[model samples]
Target: MATLQDYRNERLRKLAALRELGVDPYPAHAERTHTCAEVVEKFDELIGQTVSVAGRIVSIRSFGKLAFIKLRDASGDVQLYLQKDDVAGLDASRGVLGMKQLKLLDTGDFVQATGEMVVTKTGEKSVGVHELRLLTKSLRPMPEKLDNKEERFRRRYVDMNVNPEVRQRFIRRSKFWQATRDYLNQHGFTEVNVPVLEHTTGGADANPFVTHMDALDDQQFYLRISHELPLKRLIGAGFEKVYDLGPRFRNENYSDEHLPEHIAMEWYAAYWDWRQGMRFMENMYKDVLQKTFGTLHFRLGEFEVDMSGKWDVWDYAEVIAQHYGIDVYHTTIDEVAAKLKEHSLEVEKTDSIPRGIDKLWKNIRKSVAGPVWLVNTPKFISPLSKANPDNPQSVERFQPIIAGSELGNGFSELNDPIDQLNRFVEQQRMRDAGDDEAMMLDIDYVEMLEYGMPPACGWGWSERVFWIFEGVTAREGVPFPQLRHEIDEVTKAIYSEAELQ
Candidate 1:
């Protein structure tokens, strides 16, 4: 393998060549009046015009006796036809450019170019080179352009230069988020930020990541798994409509479907019901699909999901009855447990069979495809939801499931203080009984409910939306993904006994 020393050797040679030409290979700065993109955009207006432009060299077509090069900046790419007879900078760094020279210029190298735009005989966009300046030298080699690979597209900053489709996806990703914010604003939802750190807490199930602070002799909290608990307090304080679209941290399993820290869009509207939440979720995504991709059909793995179609609503208990021929309200817990065992599912004797049924639904969710409102969930599984008025058995909650996994959890938020406290106490018992995923009894959240917060439906969904709508796995969407056993250099330094102690 070519090593970093080999890179230093080649770059030193370039430095020597530039020194011989009396030019600094690494200059402090370059002044330019136009970007490669702006020149091309205003081409008709700047025809025969001398424009000062700056960009990194992207493509070079050399005619040994002469050369043609393309330079790119964030705005766009511009081509340069450098005829050796008129060129000023070729003598020092001379060669048939290797994909490796792309290494020398670096696929990611920053550069500046001064040129005039002109169309070649083939009527292709091209620039006549007058001058070139190096910004930052790139030493790393990029994937071969003609390889037409899939992974390079996932490392999409590199692919954006070579693949038009990859570039367009990112462009759409940008617009997709912008459109969501615009929609939220139009609906009178005020954006609010919640503290990631907590002392005494309330939120969804799952263990929190523990962090310590020596100076205060306190264990400083790391961050939250979800934004639900804090946002609810804002609801209690009378913010009628609120939303938070940001990153949430969870210490959990790693899979194509999960990331430890991920983006989520949580929204709460006062005086709303589970039905209202359903309408908003269904309509919000359909509009986002239209605004982003201009269509509702998204290729989810091998299957196609139509977002614009009717969202089939399924009751949790009814679906369980339909799927397993067992109902918790009508059947004994032991019978539910027995049916699950008949289906080859197992659970600790301490766990209720409804918990086993919950597991089955998650497994079956993978086979399901589309926008589905999975409602009327079991009370044992959803601690934050209100028990149904009619059934009193299942909670009034549902998740928007798409492509098998839940897009998010939503419900008619439980605001009755007595019932909420009882649920919290039950949760504490579950935690004491060795279920670490059980939530702690958050007395404050219950206290706030006693103050009479309005009956509002709140939904918290982490942005597995990118995974669902964009047709990629959850881990595939995050930029810097967490690796299970990888020890990064910077982290190692911080974790060293001398530093940590």
Candidate 2:
């Protein structure tokens, strides 16, 4: 069995041989008149006409005087036919390789083929090559199969090549975000990119990743845990309809639905309440989902979700009371903790009444297969939401429950500085009492609130939405997930002379 290093060494020797022959093995340019897919799709019209195609060589077969190469580009793959008598000789200046030089090419090498469309005797659509040019020479061949989770993530580029479905998943991921932007833009929302680093991060109950800014007197700054505060700050700055789509960092452990860092989008519409926001999101969800997946219905895990129909509205307080027998408005910390323990949930010493009740709610949420809006959450649990006028204990907050998880959150923006300050102070007290996930008090944001932002409704959701609908884990959904740095023994041995550890 030849090891990877042995195969690499063999390629290296071939690279040297090509160099010695004055052939440019790694050329800077190649010509492509059509994609592999186009060659096949337009075959009837393109028949007998010379066309240039470039792609990675996926396969090669030779029978004495004749050979075939399967070239694969992003669009698709096509076959190239070659005959020793008809092909041109090597041209070092143009980087063209004759039929005799095909022995130097490998399966993973990139090449351009200029040929006339034809059908083989066996009736396979292919290109009859007159000229072949080397574009790139791959030293390390891609693995035939990449199924190990650890290796797949570590070498994602190789995983994408070996498993094309992984590549297609990311294409859909791009579509998901593009659909979001399309819907938001169609609704007249102006996208403004906000700062990724903040002096005080306070949007959510998640510990933030900290960093030092040498340009700003070496002050300690935080990687933003949410885009909510800064985007809302734009609302205070007189932006009527605003949104941002970018990465946010959260210093936390991973879960199936959560990553320490992920892309999220938040939008705010001035003068809109939670109810209006709810309606807007329903349409946006339908539009985005239909555009990305081409359907409004999804089978996510064991639950079936249909975004086309009217979504049910569930009162947060009522759901908690009915499921766990605890009034969210009047629940005691001890009572919440006891219920948490009875339900086999996490009961931490730092768990406040709000946190404990939330855990109990999530337990019930696990069974709900819904496109449901969970509204009227307690004011204490929603620090940035406006308090409901009808019920002061509850805030005008709304969350979309889908496939047993909260996919999105929205709130009637709280613009009252005094109320926001009090909530911040309360959250600070929780932090002092050993709750590391409590929101930090951002006085600057409070000052902006004092300056008076308009009545608005704000909503945000992470790429977890795409992950959920796409039926992939947090790590799998991302092209490259963060992993602890490590050098394998094989890699270290390969680079031993370069002082690799």
TM-score of each: 0.85, 0.99
| lDDT of each residue in 1-501, candidate 1, tens digit only | 865457556766765654665555566767788878878788898777777776666665665655666677767787776655544544334222222222245444566655677787767666665665566665444445734444452355666665555556567767777888888899899999887777655577767777766766877765677788788889999999998888777778877777778777788888999988888878888887799878888888856788877899888877777878877567677776777677777656666555677766775677788678888888888888988988788888979888887887888988899998999999898889887678888888888889988988887766567666777666545544565344445445644665532
Instruction: Indicate the TM-score of model 1.
Output: 0.85
**Top candidate when judged by lDDT against the true structure:** 2
* Per-residue alpha-carbon lDDT of candidate 2 for residues 1-501, written as tens digits (9 for 90 to 100): 999899889988888877877889887777899999999999999999999999999999988689999999999999999988878888877778877778888899999999899999999899999999889989998788889999999999999999999999999999999999999998899999999989999789998898999998999999999999999999999999999999999889999999999999999999999999999999999999998999998999999998899999999989888888888877688889888888889998788888888888899899999999999999988999999999999999999999999999999999999999999999999998889899999999999999999999999999999999999999999999999898898898878898875
Backbone collision tally, model 1:
1
CA lDDT of each candidate? 0.72, 0.92
Error of 2 at 306 (Å): 1.4
- Stretches of model 1 off by over 4 angstroms after superposition: 1-8, 16-42, 63-65, 84-108, 145-170, 220-222, 330-333, 346-350, 484-501
User: Residue 349, candidate 1: how far off, in angstroms?
Assistant: 6.4
